[model samples]
Target: MAAGLLLLVCAGAVLYSAQAQDPYDGLPDDYKKGVDLAMEKLTLDPGVRHHFRFLKTLDKSDIESGFGVKYIYHHFYLKPTRCAKGSTVSNAQTCPFRNDRPLIDCAVCYKTAADQIESFPKPYVHCIQKPRLTEDTRTTRTEHCKKMNYNSGAPTLLAVSMPKN
Candidate 1:
């Protein structure tokens, strides 16, 4: 019975790890509201009324707290559309809207010390109309939000890309 108890104790202690955590676990309610705002108004074109399809918010393990503010990254995928008139396309293939799928990221910085949570004015995360080359250099839109620096401690999202077709 003593040996069984010792084994059980060791097993219990080994299984009692508590580091498990969700990146968005302690996120402020306003963050969701901000995402909603982005969803409602985020568009591919200001003049064309082309709205973006909200994919997901970029996740980070370092999002628990900050002194003054927290930046919430909201990512949305925008399909390629015709380039607006007067825009210079040096290679024609490099025409931003013609070949590459634009991944627009809205990074909203929320004031953490605010007295009013919901009433706080929405963050002005500008639309990223530019696209970068994909990591694999492939044209398919496989660039969903994921953590970087796998072995290293600091995880980050690589910039959205415009890979070669």
Candidate 2:
């Protein structure tokens, strides 16, 4: 009787924890599962506050095991907001951040209940951080920030494959 009670209590605690982390009920089950899995798997340094914004669906596939969808999203590395020295106000425009310049493409896939996992090929062009302006290097290329000729458009699907389980 004691063992049975303990088991029941453990199961209830697990259920409660699961319910606490469940995403909005209105969201499709696949998306919720994918977000949860991604959140659980992806981790950065404790100091960096990162966010994942779903940009678009790259591709989708129906297989024998389950459905799989490839998604590209912005993984924003956020800096905590703070007022500038000697300034008493804080707003979006006044405050500066490292994320101002441009964004790049990164891809991830929904977790499927299958032996194989499908994902997009590795991106060729990796994102680079804007060069910081020091006293010496300020007069060089950093001056007059010229915009690159590329568009802020989503990447085309060049290749997709399923990794062996």
Query: Candidates' lDDT values, in order?
Result: 0.40, 0.33
Q: What is the Cα-based TM-score of model 1?
A: 0.32
**Cα deviation of 133 in candidate 1 (Å)?**
10
In order, how many clashes per candidate?
3, 0
Give a tens-digit lDDT track for model 2, residues 1-165.
999999999999999978554123434554444433433333232432433322333332222321332322212221323333223322322444344433222222322334333332221112222243244432332221112212223232222353446
Task: Flag clash pairs in model 1.
Answer: 132-161, 132-162, 133-162
Model 2 scores a TM of 0.26
The residue-by-residue lDDT of candidate 1 on 1-165, one tens digit each, is 999999999887767643223223344565555554554455434553433433345632223233333333343333334544333324322333444455655544333334222223334443444454343422122222122111222222222343546
- Candidate 2, residue 149: Cα displacement in angstroms equals 38
Structural similarity to truth (TM-score) of each candidate: 0.32, 0.26
Report the C-alpha displacement of residue 150, candidate 1, in angstroms. Answer: 30
